[model samples]
Every structure is written in structure tokens, then in C-alpha cells.
Target: MSQPSQALQIRTSDGIVFDVCLEVAQQMGLTHSWLQSERGDLKCSDGPDDDANVMPLNRVRSDIFKLVLDWCQAVQTVDTPLEHKEMLQHQRSLFQRILTESNATDSTIFELIIAADYLNIDGLLQAGTQHVADVINGCDSVEAIRERFHIMYEGEIDE
Candidate 1:
């Protein structure tokens, strides 16, 4: 069953405001509910004043957010694809690089992958998942991936 939607006001880093549905806002990273929005608009974790370059992060560091948005724009427009703006193999190579360097790189790529998944960006998701799968299917065992990603294992008994 779908959760009941609520009203919410959100401000992006650019100072632009949006009257977002509560459910969509909940999709964001934070423990919040309708109660918080009762009095007035709530300042979110990704508020424009948020310091992405500093401690408190803004939705996928500012520069990375712009990069992801650029990728989205290029991928979404049919004209852009047909215009041969970027080759498919080139895009795959980029995703592959992001997937592999997930540890060394900033969290922006993962955030972008999550956003793409939520938005039903299948191409990006597949590419990202493949990159992740490659990591898992590499010399590292299943236990390695779990350890790297911090997943609690409950299925296996102690050896």
C-alpha cells in the first residue's frame, strides 16, 4: 500500500523553491515525517545554505550534482542521443570508471546512481549495476563486497 502523501516545501541549493509532495521529500536522506512540516517550510539537508564542500553535505556535492544533471539532460533528450553528442561506449566507459573507483571517488556518483534508479533511468542503472556487479564478481569474494559496503550478514553460520 502506498503511504498517504503530505504537503512540503523544499529549497534547492540554488535558492529556487519547490512545493514538493511529502512522499517525494521522504525519498530524501533523513528521518522526517508530516509532523515536521506542520508549522512551516522545513529546511532540508540539501538546503542551498548547506555546505557541500564542508562538513554538512548538500545533495551530492555541488560540482558532481551539476555533472549528474548534465548526464541526465544528455540521456533524457531523444534529440541529444540521435545527434551523436556522445557515444554509447564512451558513456559505458565513464560508468565503469565510476563503479570501480567508488571507494576512492566522492559519493556523488553513488548518489547520482540512486537518483537515476528512482527516476527510472534504466540505462544508467544497468550501467551502474554492472559496474557494481563487476566489483562483486572480481577476485574479491562475496564476503569482500559485504565488508566493503558494510552489510550485516545473517544468512551464514559461523564456520
Candidate 2:
């Protein structure tokens, strides 16, 4: 008989751990070619094992990691109701509300982009980068960009 794939234990920098299916993780691009070599036996070449395959994501914050995982789960499922324009609008509103409630700032979005890039999650990288662009689009000045991105310039300005 064939054995089923095992769940992977992903530990974030803040000590939060998530048990995710290998297939789902791979679908999110969380697993790469280098991971197999770096993690060695944790890749489970033979079959599923009882021990959790620990993958430490020391660079990503726990909350952001959870958010990405949630996004992955959400994308994996099909929602028929969301096809309607009204429903889609409502969902977008809800998403915005959640971000507002969570105090998700531009810095958070940038962090998500960095984490996504490091993890090779193309979907997240695209979404995050697009979000940043959308925020800065049509803005008039460098100050506006800096303010929106919560970045401070320490270096000397040219001209």
C-alpha cells in the first residue's frame, strides 16, 4: 500500500508554528529545490513519518506568516458566491476593513512583499507589489511616497 504525504511544520521567527500539508505548501511556492538539500531527511523521500518536518522561517514574522497561510487556504478553495459583482465588492470591503482593523500599514505590506519574495510565493509578491503601487499611483511627490511607505531618508539629497 502507498503512504500519504506528510504535514510540514513551519516555524516562524516569533516562535509560531503551523502544520501544513506538503501539497498545499508546494502550491504556495513555499518549497523550493534548495529546501530539499538544506532540510535533508525532513523532505520525506521514503514516505510520511510521525516526526514533523520542521522548516524554520526565521526571517518572517509570525502574524505575517499566518496571514500568508490564510491567503493560501483561501485561494485553494472555490467560492461560487464570489462570482457576483456585489459579492466581490462586499468581499473587498471586508478585506479592507480587516486590514484597517488590524492596522495594516504600508510597511506591513512591504514586509509581506519581502517575505513573499524570499519564499518565492509569486502570487503574494504580485499582490503586495501591486498594492504598494496602487497606493502610490497618481501621487505628486517624493514626500507623498515616503509618507505613504513610512520611510525616512537619512542620506544626503542630490540637487
List the RMSD of every prediction in angstroms: 11.7, 6.0
Model 1: how far is 76 from its true place, Å? 8.0
List the candidates' TM-scores in order.
0.42, 0.67
RMSD of 2: 6.0
Worst 10 residues of 1 by lDDT: 51-60
Per-residue lDDT of candidate 2, residues 11-55 (tens digit): 789977778766667755556543575564464435334334667
- How many backbone overlaps does candidate 2 show? 0
Query: Model 1: per-residue lDDT, tens digit, 80-159?
Result: 44333355565677666544554434245566676556544556666666666666787367678777666667775466
Q: Please estimate how well model 1 matches the true structure, expressed as its whole-model Cα lDDT.
A: 0.50
- Model 2 scores worst on lDDT over the 10 consecutive residues at 43-52
Candidate 1: give the clashing pairs. Answer: 13-48
